[model samples]
Target: MPEHGHKTPHLQEHLLNIPVPDYAPELRQLVFDYTLQLADTSLILGHRLSEWCGHGPILEQDLAMANIALDLIGETRSLYQYAATLEGKGRTEDDLAYLRSAVEYKNPLLVEQPNGDFGDTVMRQFLFDGFHYFLLKALKHSSDQGLSAIAAKSFKEASYHIKWSSEWVIRLGDGTEESKHRMEKAVGNLWMYSGELFMMTDTEKQLLEAGILPDYTSIKQQWDEHVAKVFSEATLEVPQQVYMQQGGKMGKHSEHLGYILTELQYLQRTYPGLEW
Candidate 1:
């Protein structure tokens, strides 16, 4: 489930890892918050995907899930390293990844939802991938060259994620009667979580204005259109007018995050300083 060990050579490990004063103090803090959120989201989802590493329903998908989990974790590492640099707090990526409290994690509640079943996992991935695809596309043009580089690197992976997840959604939605029913259940159970992906906080709004991130409204539109197109082909209904969950960006989370943090932080907490 874990990616690189908690320890790695800091940002200096990469030629492109250099951090520049790309914004004023206030904006720099905003960028740090945003970057940390991105890292946290990927790390938690990556861990969830990793649970399927040896337990995939089929051999092919098992391997694929592991790879995708690795991709997200890899991206998480880069984002964390960048975040540590921006923090200027003498913290390493390991500290930032493993030392944070439950409320300190900034991932949306959606990603933290337990992976109930294969159908549920697929639905979760598809919903996130849909948004991720467009977010990366916009980030590729970020005025901050460092962020742009990371987004450009991640764009292809996000593209493949949506393609893979979309196929499963279609297959499950349009497959056998049992498969379709399970998929429908997955859709209903997960749809509400989808709204939080686009619910931006003041930090994100500022970043959008600074050209560091894209507008959530526009991203949500693209996400909705893509989801509707896919769900329609799958013979599924895209839920509308649902109550949206918020507060992840503000550090409030569902109960699930506490459990995740306990397990995730165990190795570090037990050891205190070194990477195990």
Candidate 2:
């Protein structure tokens, strides 16, 4: 049990009491919508990574990937559980995650990409972790204690995540010609979708005004510096992609989320109210 007088359920200890905006119903919905978007991205990404359970390059790599996926899943559970509590409409995390239609998810398209090769996986994490690190750092100051506590605690884990991933990025980039080529290609493919993660909506604006959330614009600058530093260390060049894809925060998602949902919600869809 943690010092909070309850047994910490994995990542549950981080659910602190950061005050959110006291907006009326409509504004509350907006803030929740934004928060859910962040949650969904990590949730979906964790699902995708979980698929690599048995097929990792080696046992160590497999365990490493699985551990990372577990961390993401842990983070997702905390975020979703808190979001449900805020909803105050008798909704559960399972209900929000499984019962929602595909159009209701706000996960970015980047997370839905098929995990092709180890290089692809590493490149994807590299891109996303850079952004997540900054977002969580900014979130530590969120007026919402729940989110700020989650961020403060998770930020430590995310730092390790960034370290582990950056090590792989550097190794693959400088290891051999084959690895270098594969990583380079993976970076190119993933770079186009990177911009959407930082794009904020009106809900975010309200949260920022009410001090419920951090300013994403400032976080973007820090993200750029961090990414640039990691890329340089990895001997990789940041792609100068001209076009950027957007629109996942508004319950918009990629084609892959539907397939992911089919599998994720299968048990719940098949047996309503069933639990272990």
Candidate 1 per-residue lDDT over residues 62-177, each given as its tens digit:
99989999889888988888888888889988899898898889999889888888999999999999998999899889887767888898899999999999999999999999
Model 1: what TM-score? 0.93
Candidate 1 — worst ten consecutive residues by lDDT sum? 7-16
lDDT of 2 at 156: 88
Task: Name the candidate that leads on lDDT.
Answer: 1
- Candidates' RMSD to native: 4.2, 3.6
TM-score attained by model 2: 0.90
- lDDT by candidate, in order shown: 0.88, 0.81
Stretches of candidate 2 exceeding 4 Å from the true structure: 1-23
Off-target runs (Cα >4 Å) in candidate 1 are: 1-15
